[model samples]
Structures are given as structure tokens and as C-alpha cells.
Target: MSKTINIGLVPFSCVKLAEADFKDRAAVYVVLCMKDNNEWTVLDAGQSCEVNASADAHPRNAMWKTHCPAGNIWIGTYPMPTAGYSKADRFAMERKLRRQYKPPCGKR
Candidate 1:
């Protein structure tokens, strides 16, 4: 079973990523939530808009033991190379961030 973590307050800009106004075709995003000591930590991360379309996409409900509402979730969107960005590049970047942050909700 995946570990459950608290998704607390985050920046307003981060919350906007999940919104239609902020969603972009070429982007990578990381979902962040508050961890202990009041520090924001990565809860999950991904690089595709298609995968993010589902209700369980952000925190991946199947992996987590608890549920986090939309208000508790924040996304940090990274603009990708529009001209030549490839799937491999996106995957690599996601792996890099996952390695660094070790977000509990992300794939192992």
C-alpha cells in the first residue's frame, strides 16, 4: 500500500495549474502539499495533460490510503520545449524530480 500524506496549503499559482485557465498542452506539473514543519513537499508529479484528466490523476487515489480534495492540492507546471519535446524527455524529467523529492504518492 502507498503511504498517505497531508496535502496542506500551497501557493495560489500552484492551485491554478489544475484549472482550465492554467492548463497547457506542453507542460510538466508537480503536485505539492504541506509536509511536517510547515514545509511544502511534493505529493506527486507527472508530465502529461491526458493522464492528468482523470479524477484520481493528481494524488492517484489507487495508491493512497486517504483522499485529498482539490482545494488541498497544488500543481507546479513547468513549460516544456514546444518545438522538440519528446515523451522520453518528459519521462526523464519526471523521474529526476521524483528522485529528488521522493513524493509519497508518486510511482516507485
Candidate 2:
């Protein structure tokens, strides 16, 4: 299925896609999700916003990560989120990204 991303506490300007729509696109959506959201991962994003986002929120590759800059996950009205970028926040994110993530098999 395409992946959808959860941008919690959203400002409302972002596109909202249904689960069906997320198929085959999950990777793209996840890569585009806001890097600042505490739930940078799909699971976390959903939990933070109480919304089930796309499963593809977690991609298994490095090229995709570079293509989809985390900052591009646009928010609508509310001021942009900054949690993931702060020193403390970034440290935490680095931990999460490293600990929780298991790259696709053989991805190295």
C-alpha cells in the first residue's frame, strides 16, 4: 500500500489522503512528512495526532530519504513545528531513528 504520513497537531494546510490513497505512495508521503513532528515515524505521527497515518511512513532506503527532505512536509495554518530540530529534540530523534528503524533486509 502507498504510505501516508501523520503530521500531528497539523495546521490544516496539508493534504489528507485516505488509507486507500496511500497505497504505492507510502514511501513518498512518509519522506515528505514534517521532520519537526515528534512522530517523525508513521506510528509516532499517528499516535501524536490520534490519527492512523500511512504505513509507508517508514521507508527502508537512503536515496528516498535524501529525495524527500523532512522540512517539506508542509503544515497549513499553525506555526511550523520545531521539536525534531532542537539539540535535545534532535538527539532524541537520532536515537529513535536509529533504534526503532530496521533497514530493509540487505539494504545496509
Best by TM-score: 1
Cα lDDT tens digits, model 2, 42-105, are 3112112211243335343344444345533321121123432334443344344334543222
For residues 22-103, what per-residue lDDT tens digits would candidate 1 score against the true structure?
A: 5346666676654445456677767774433443343474443242433444455565655778877777777877887788
**What are the TM-scores, per candidate, against the unseen true structure?**
0.60, 0.23
- Residue 51 lDDT (model 2): 19
**Distance from true position, residue 27, model 1, in Å?**
1.4
Question: Which residue pairs clash in candidate 1?
Answer: none
Q: Which residue segments of model 1 deviate by more than 4 Å?
A: 1-13, 16-20, 35-38, 49-71
- Name the lDDT value of residue 44 in candidate 2: 19
